[model samples]
Target: MPSHPNYSNQGNKFAPAKTSLREAGDLYGQKEFHIYQNAIEKMRAHDDQLPSLPIITLEIRKATSNPNVNLNHLSSLIAKDPSLTAILMKHASSVFYRTADKPKNLQDVIKRLGMGAIESLTLSHSIKSLFVLRNHQLKALYKQAWQRQTLKACMSYHLAKTLHFPNPEDAIVASLLSEVGTLALLSSLQDYAAPAAPTYKILCQHYSKHLGAILLAKWGVSPVFVDVLRKTGAWTLDTGRLLQLVDVINLGLFHTIHYLQPQNDLIPLQEIAAFKKLNPQYAMIKQQKLLIIEENISHILQLQKNFE
Candidate 1:
């Protein structure tokens, strides 16, 4: 069969190649397949130059993990990073918080956000630095990917809060980290130059979970969070009798995809097993899921404006 042409960045845009569609796909796939594998192998061998978790992020994670987290100390740490402090203040004053008054200062922002949301926001603010690249096209691709992940993370957090899930913040962290593999794979592609968009996406879908799980484990992330990487797009996922963070992550992923590609042929939310589990506990989700999504979409756009 005649296949779509995979254009090389260096070549004429309309130049035809002798390669068949299947051949082109296989060639691109094989090349990226190797790159993805190499990236994973390097991570496994602990010799990769992939970005390490930021120290401020680590400190925030440690502080928040404690039940007795000191808001004053935590605010002080975040205040040390002026940009982060600004992001937090902007987020606290955002319409999503529904606060009657704007935060007076960093400590007020920290108090309004709470430790869990603070952790998620802190990590989200710093995640972009992890995937920086000199390749312009690849860099744009990574930026889009990062933005989508951030939106998904916000969607997860909102979904959890809407459903009254116990640890909504966990949903945010899990959803954000779900794309760790994709970012890492894209970073690896910097040296390989840009692959056709479809090829890179295929590589991400096929191998991101494995690579992400490996990287998160190495970073000392909780297994519960690491498992979110494994179950990200599992539409049929059923995790025990109760709704869990992974279920929220799955639902968030579904909504994020639907929001980005409304015409996509994804399974309807009512039909998905995750939504089914949530339906029994929160019937309002079935009725207001779209509204919930609409609100999250608005919030995501606002966040991009603030942080971008």
Candidate 2:
């Protein structure tokens, strides 16, 4: 299993709480350990407060699941949420899908984007609501979190489509929900004093994957997604099989950190187990893989912005 340079030392799998706190103390300063500890305790104690998928999103999914579902009915369901309707309109007109004639209305937008893209976009829109925060500092963190996740979703969608995956929406959902644990933590911090940025980041690195898995399980998401969240950042994680949604997310994260976001502690693409597995499956050279992302970046950014 490949380990992240920053996160590998915490060990694979969720650590026992007491053990995690001790490791937190060691990795972060003692001053911030208590803060991380209390936050975790609060999150666990208030586990029921973790956000649920919106009723409307559930309705949309239930409706979309029908083989003979009505597009007009789907459009009406989405129109109930005006903001979501606006987002759909904007996305349809975005350069990624810009035909000579733009989609004229919600129904047309739905037809243009297709059921898979609509479902992914609706889920992505619903998930963003969970990241809204009142804490001034946490607000910035949440914004960054949203942006990173959106970037992941964009990259994941394109990669899945390029690799000829059966359902690219699965990759979109995985990328969108990857940092849900971080949102779970930030959501719990409404009345609490926000920790310093560095401490808050350390807290997320240590706790998000575990908490996200728990929340997704509680919300009854697919086991595949729950597993993906739990194993996030396990870069060398080879399932010793064909490419999976986890590989899509791993590749997305690599692009986000190394290329899109450009972090300091960069890891080479060759070192990633997912890249090694996925790269050849597409039969593209290293530069070509990056080129795929580079070519679609503006479109991805447009989708990300419209998603907001």
Candidate 3:
């Protein structure tokens, strides 16, 4: 069994609350673990079937990596997907991306937004498309996961803004991809004849980080985002170095879990090394207050409505 970097010894006084998961692993004997490994191998063999961005998007991603890639080349790729074309045009004309006049076509959108914003939008949609699972039984599961992720993304956005982080959208993107590992794992099990087994869920937790990075790489997601997948769930990491994005993600997870299950024993914010670096007073965000019971219930609703 491939083990993740032990997240427990953050050198903090509090022990990591991975006991439930670790205990779950213990409950699954060697035979159960092998069943998952075999299923995972079966899924990996049919890699092409895994949901991903259209080839055009992947091509644009590769082309954009070249600093000197021509803008016309990008336009050509964007024109290939009508769905992508419509989405880019609609968003490019929205209040945020709109120029003085509405852009008429894909070429106009690229020119107006520039390659950086265009790339992010493309990657965002590309990654999100994977969440539209083919398995109908998983619809309820996807909805629960998507809603939770949206909440975390919203928390990350406000946290980044409050901390004066330059890119709040990074936090949102990170939040969405945070569950990639589990999602990828479950999708691989779509053809596994067994019911959604307990050991499969446990295995997803164990190997999610590694599997997530692979999926992101396949989609040509930026390395920074790949790094985000690795570290956001790490509670005890030195927040001083990766203070803004990484710390905001940790905070987002904490609050999202706290909202979902008020009594969850995942690390307290005050005790977390990342939150400690913040002023803790939340002085920057005077207007927006979270509720003690619901704990940002309105924010959760707003995020679901916006992202859904």
lDDT winner: 2
**lDDT, candidates in the order shown:** 0.68, 0.71, 0.62
Q: Native-vs-model 2 lDDT?
A: 0.71
lDDT tens digits by residue: candidate 2, 1-308: 11122331122112112234465456555755576567676776677767778899999888877778898899889999999999889878987678999887888998888887788778878888865678887687677667667777778877888888887868878887777777777777766677655455566665676677777877677888877776667878776677888888877776766544343344566777777775544545454246677767777777678766
Ranking by TM-score: 2, 1, 3
Per-residue lDDT over 1-308 for candidate 1, one digit per residue giving the tens place of the 0 to 100 score? 11211111101111122444576467554756676556545654563566778888899889988998787888778878888888888878886685678889877887787887888778777766677788998887777776677767777877888888766777767887777776776776676667665455445545566666667876777788887777767677677777788888877777776666554446667777677775654534533255666645776667556556
* TM-score of candidate 1 relative to the true fold: 0.82
Best by TM-score: 2
Q: Per-residue error at 264 for model 2, in Å?
A: 3.1
Window of ten residues with lowest summed lDDT in model 1: 4-13
How well does candidate 2 score on lDDT at residue 18?
Answer: 25
Candidate 3 residue 206 C-alpha distance from true site, Å: 2.0
Decide which is better by lDDT, 1 or 3.
1
Candidate numbers sorted by lDDT from highest down: 2, 1, 3
